[model samples]
Target: MGTINDGNTHPGATLPWGMASALPHTKDFREKANGPAYYNFGDEKIYGFGNVNLSGLGCPVAGAVPLKLSTGKFDWDIENFASTYKDEEAYAGYYKVTLEKHQLVAEMTATTRSTIYNFTPQNDDKQPINLFLDLGANTSHRKGGSLKVVSPQLITGSQLDGAFCGFQKSTNIYFALEINQPNPQVKIYENQKVTDKREVKGDKAGVVWTLDQLDQGKLEVRVGISFVSEKNALDNLRKEQGDLSFEGIHQKAIAEWNKQLQKVDIETSSNDDEQIFYTALYHSLLLPHVISDVNGEYYSREIDKVLVADDYTRYSTYSLWDTYRTLHPLLALLYPKEQRDMVVTMLEMYKEWGWLPKWELFGYDTFVMVGDPAVPVISDTYLKGITDFDTELAIEAMLATAANTKKNPTRPGISQYIEHGYIPIDDRGGDPQKFSWTNGIVWGPVSTTLEYNLADYNIAQLANVLGKNELAKEYYRRSDSYKKLYDPKTTFFRPKLKNGNWMESFNPTDRFFDIRWEGSGGKGFVEGNAWQYNFFVPHAMNDLKSLMGEEVFLSKLNDLFSNGEYDLTNEPDITYPYLFNYVKGHEKKTQQLVREKGDLHFTNTPSGIPGNDDAGTLSAWLVFSQLGFFPDAPGIPTYQLTTPKFEKATIHLDDYVYNGQTIEIIKTGENDRYFNQFTIDGKVREEVYQLSHQELVSTNELVFNTVSERLSEVKE
Candidate 1:
């Protein structure tokens, strides 16, 4: 997992929903040895530390503000400042490393928007302790930036970022740094020149502070991060970490992590399985970061102005196309309050940008993926009873995005979709490639049709919740449009032209059968073949069963596993294992497949994750599967049940949004591949395959008596 193209996640020392993630700045600062992610686990030489790098994302954006504590030297080159270190340690909200070259120890901990550093020189020698701030050493390409020396102990600056996958350029980050040393000498470098001015502007500048006197050879520093202005950065630093020592900040960060991690408690005998589960849990909590400061002031790229979040937190960095499937659902379930803010954040974006983000990064919609995913995420969150946002505005935004038939940013080729119920393979109406998302021609029309169906059904659900039955019916019909693409001859969802004719060549297994959208291969399906993407009509699975025949549906579902087409690295077919429950007498297959896939793909190693976690989509799959249920159908408010890995696992529930304080999922007989019976508080359930949202969270005890699949039959 090198932070690009696949499931390589870096170690992030950021709290849940924290903006500043302190990571090791390895020697790869010269290039993207690991994309925009700063840490390279295999690299022995670390230059310093950086903040605001993302973890487990398919594409990288910013790895900004690299700083190091060096002594007896002042060089602008990264090689001069780079040092080989050993005994590296990393955890949630905390990172520690020993620099062998500089003979110093560096430890970092973070608040929501700040980083506190503690540096101790191993050999003082009475030499001046040099603090190096490399404003030009970003892993992403440099644009332009500015820096100002506020005083001997403080400095404020900002750097231009946002080249996410060669698209979008508005993720500029600002920072304010404060050191504990009093009356220190400052040396500024601009384009490799030791400048005499107190201000430096450009991408080729760095600042060095030489201090001969320190409090017992210990250097303490705090950095506040902001996306709006430098004043907000300094204000964030002053209020957030006021009077907190290095040790105090480190302990507070650990305590914050514990508070979030303790929301779920599990009883498992396998330490490896437990470690993997918690690691996944930690990763799941790292995204959709809060970008607003304590004063609620943030820059809105949609409006090109700084606005204050009056009653809620403003968040950015939404990988919606990837996280909409399961991550948003998980957040809605466990973190409803925060999820409500996120929904409001999207709604605010709509009010200003006139469209929901396809893949929003740092307040800008990159249009990185196909379809309107924000519909499912926001609709799903609202449908789950998290109604703290504007309802009328939400409905208006969804209707606008869904009904737009011309030059839509979220949904391209929408007019073709409306006229024919499905987009044609040859329709090239919208921008061929908006921004830098490499969608050739019409941008995966077959897949976009399916994606729009899911999104439309989610909006229909939202509409139904508001007693708008007629409006719900309209979207429901739109949702069933995926049925038009089903090829009876091939028994798969094939690409059809505008005139109701199939494409001349149909190869279901050819990954790159047609054009590509960015790195997501395949023409008809983004990053998937027909065998993987054809089962995407979760909203109309009954219709799919009728169209493909129940036997064909089951056979094709089984073929995914038998032919190795069940890609856990991607999202299209991740829910196929749970789809067995939709068919009769196939519940045991779901149980076995879910457990096997979880154990096989998810482990306690660096490569334990099978693919791009896609902003914790796969990790949320593991968390849900290991805890014994999954939100298989997006925006449906239903969870498909499977075998539980733990004997007893308790999940904290929202008292206001849900009916219970805690819900326990207990597996009684054994941790095995199959289960024989399912009950809620000793009462047998007629429908053992799934549970409604109200029914699942309100229940106190949901038990699954499992057994080994020594018996491999579909039913007992």
Candidate 2:
């Protein structure tokens, strides 16, 4: 799931939310570590490792500094340094692999900020280990950097990388590399040009070293990275790994992962579902990663300055447009305190960046995807009872983005959306500053309008909770703007021209909206067709049903699945299966669709994930589905009930918030697919559609009386 579909998750040693990863780079037939993913099943030749990478994201994640090692001599040909290998093993915070050509065994362990590597070279000649520190080699575009050898055993440098999803946002990575061996000789390389100078700086710069001495017949290296500065990188390495042995650090990392995984435990009959479930859980927690240094300092790309976090730990890499759906809600459920800090991070981003994050990467607003997504994420968190931050400031930020018209970064066409009820397809105000919106640059006016409607819907949710009824009413009315885009002729939400005319000959399946005359054949739906985005109104489900009529809505939903319209790859319709619960007496369809999609798309292989993880966007969908509840409508803080894959699933809620309570879901009955009903702590539920956060944590158990194949008919 992490390796395929541009998930780009490297097989390496990295702590939970760790800034640095020790990734094993390979020289493959297509492309090796120089590509998005560091380790794939088909990759050949192991060329040592790189120090940092983005995990499970959909963009091209550049390698910070790749360290390639060989056992014999100094060579300018980096191609000759790699060796073919076997025997690979990976665990949390640890990875082990062997180089078959050189008979070398390499292992790595990671801290939150650094990755510690151990290499054992079984060279019959007992030659010194030769290593290359490539500052220039990157998986993505490398914008020239500088490197210096501070000492015989130490090297420090920085690499400038940017344009996540082709958005013009760059991050400067600084690293301090240390060799555990004593009496090491060094040289420099600038674009493969060798020099005796201890320092080098260029587009292709690196430091080569030969280590003659080793401890216990092993060569160990440590590299720490920071976005702030080289000094902070060195201090991060020293502060975390100081006075600790390799085993001690590895054990500490393992313990931390154990504690994290222990939050949710499951017992199930199907072994594959269990493996896939835990793997999904693991992938879900790897994003919105820690960006603050050990001393609580971080580089703010929004302001182009270094800022202090003061008290709370800062984090970045918010793929909010994707994560606000379920990843954050899951966090708000399992780890409210951590989720609180994440909310604080988002608020801080608004304060520093002048706008909330669209798809934030290291404090840089990539604005990769459409929508003011921070609205739903913060509102969802607050509605779930984790309100510790400034309520006024949050509301203020929401209002600013909701009202700001000209040069709006998050909401591109606010004034147009307000005047026309929905954004017009020809609105020039929708052009994004630095974003790749699939085929064309005329940002999905229809899709962006839907995103804005959802954002406004969530803003209303927050406003209602804050006791501002008039403000809530205004936003709620604004949220129903999706109704204007709904064309009665096609019965699907299609694009409308600014002149109050429908797009000529509307085709819902066309992915390219009628923008550029060349690509007008395809409907523009922001990486999807109108079919997928048609039923994406999760928040206004009842209103959507009212618009299309009850029977029409149900028939369209059935057509969506039977006619192969429900998309498993995109985010807009990921919650489609659970939509059945929104309509009464059709909850049985939700169960069947959930199980069928789970069986088809998710698996225990490299391509288990149907699409890009998008920083755990798809993985969170799987995690929630497997747990018998899906946050079908994000920002509503209500889980749509379904048949859990596991027989007995235990979700240990946050002790401080839930008062040491745990939500135990015990599913056992004649059928696994259809359940007659479920009971919460011995009380039967009249409604099967939703469960609130408060009611969920306030209970002890939810036992679903289940059935299988649904081979038997469901009893209404």
Candidate 3:
């Protein structure tokens, strides 16, 4: 599922929340550089093994310090160094490939701090084996770097990479490589020139390790990466991989993955469906990685200093705008302690950087997406009883970010959003050539307004739970700002000028950047058209339905699927399939739509995923959908029920928070397309389509019975 065209997820080896990831590299294909380090189905020759990668991002980053192994004389031609492999395999915590050209088999696995590679020669060739450390190579734009041969068995270096989607500060990665054998000859080079000195620093600096003979059975290399310092990198290597055999590390990684995957146990008849479920679960838990070292020390790009985390494990790579919809809620159900730590980490980031992260990467705030997404993520976590952090402080941060109009990059148009109740399209002069509605600069005015309104609604929910009723009332009123953009004449949330006039000549079908003419199409939304964005009011579905009228809303909603206006590849329209639950007796359509979409988009092949994992948002949606229910609203504890894919499923809740109870969902009846009835702890539930999180975790069993008819007929 990770190798889809838009998924961009590499087949890599890493522990859950590991700082470093190891994946195969196909460097000859520069046009596909925006993709992952490895595309499982592509035929590009293997260039090297990339030690660090950002999974599922549209633009690649942090594929630094590629290590290539060969058994021939030194040649500077990178093209000649690559080898073709036939047999290849990858899973949650392991990857293996055969280098047919080199007659070698390579396998890789990782711990929290380091990745270990094992290479076995197929033939007994007397030629000397060489390991090349290409410091200049990276998936993103390289600024500069340095490499030094500290010892015969050790090489240390740092690389500076920048320009993630043309935005971000240069990230410095310090690395330490340790060879298993002692006294291997090392040579340093700079700008393609062999240097006699042990140190080399420049744009094209690299190092080569030459083993005298290849008669040995296998060779192992351990690499440790750190954002703080070289010494810390070495310490990390010793702590994670010191004297550990390659098999031992591989087993450890597998055990770790099994621990996370076993949270949800299912009884399924189809092996393909089983693989899909486990893979989706695997992808859902790979992000928001722990960035702190074993000693709780990390380098903060926001603060420009090394900081110590004494209480909690600091985490990075928060794709909050994509994750808050489903991923955070899933975490609260299965991994409450980790979710609490993540919330604490976000609070700490707010304390250090003055604002919560939007799209944080490698300790840098990229500000990649719109909205105050941290509000929804933290609010969801807090409302789900994962409140191990300071609630008052979190509320203060949310209020400050929500109310700020200037000097806050996270909330771009907060002042106008607060004052005018909507962000005007004409505020930045409606010029598509001079501006973008998707990037980080004055983009998606209407979309941002909607996102801000939803975020405010989430904050209000959290505030109400925290006993701040007055503050909650204020935020709740502000959340109704989405209504200002609704143009009753167009029957859509049309973009308006600063003078309170609708942008003329609008088309709901035109996507972002689809129309070139001035104000002809989507000038206010991000990545989607009006039809997709219209159904985005997850927090206030009843209100939206009322505004559009039930018949009009139902007609338009049905048209979204039949007319091919619905987009399943992005996050903005993911909630559309679940919206039918709000209208009574319409859930059968939801079930059919969800099942059909899931079958189309998800599979067991390399290109199984429908689109970008969006740092696991899409995967989480599938996981929750297959479970027969979904947390459609972020800050709300309720989950709207549907039809389960499996006949029976069990979700193991975090015992620390949920009193060691497990929610067992049993599907009874031959029909799996419609839900006829539901029961909790054997008590029949009539006319109720929602289950609270409290009720879910505390209950021993929740059963859904299916019938051959539609829900409306059953209700009648």
Q: What would the per-residue lDDT of candidate 1 be over residues 429-469, giving only the tens digit for each residue?
A: 53543533533345677888999999999889999998899
Sorted on lDDT, best first, the list reads 3, 1, 2
Mind giving the per-residue lDDT tens digits that candidate 2 earns over 261-348?
Answer: 8889999677787778888888887888888999999989878999999878888888887889889988888878888888898888
Model 2 alpha-carbon drift over 4 Å, by segment: 27-35, 430-442, 513-522, 707-716
* Per-model tally of clashing residue pairs: 3, 12, 0
Error of 2 at 108 (Å): 0.7
In candidate 3, list every pair of residues with a backbone clash. Answer: none
Ten consecutive residues with minimal summed lDDT in candidate 1? 432-441
Q: Ten consecutive residues with minimal summed lDDT in candidate 2?
A: 27-36
> Over 4 Å off in model 1, which ranges?
1-6, 31-34, 125-128, 430-441, 513-519, 708-716
Q: Score every model by TM-score.
A: 0.96, 0.95, 0.96
The lDDT values for all models are 0.80, 0.79, 0.81
Candidate 1 C-alpha error for residue 246, in Å: 1.4
For 1-716, candidate 3 gives per-residue lDDT tens digits of 76756687778899887888888886632223444435556756788887877677666677876888777787767765699887888878899999887787999999988899988888777667888887767777654578777788888888877666557477788899988776677778888788898888886778988876632467788999888888888888889887778889889999999988999999999999999998888888888887888778998898899999998888888988899998889888988888888888888888888888888888888787688899998898888877778998899889778987667688776767877898887774335464432232546778888899889998899899988999999999999888889977777887888888899878787665532334333767777879889878788889999998887777778889989988787888897887877777677778878999999989988788988888888888999999988998888888988889999999887677887788898999768777778999999987557888888888989898887644335211
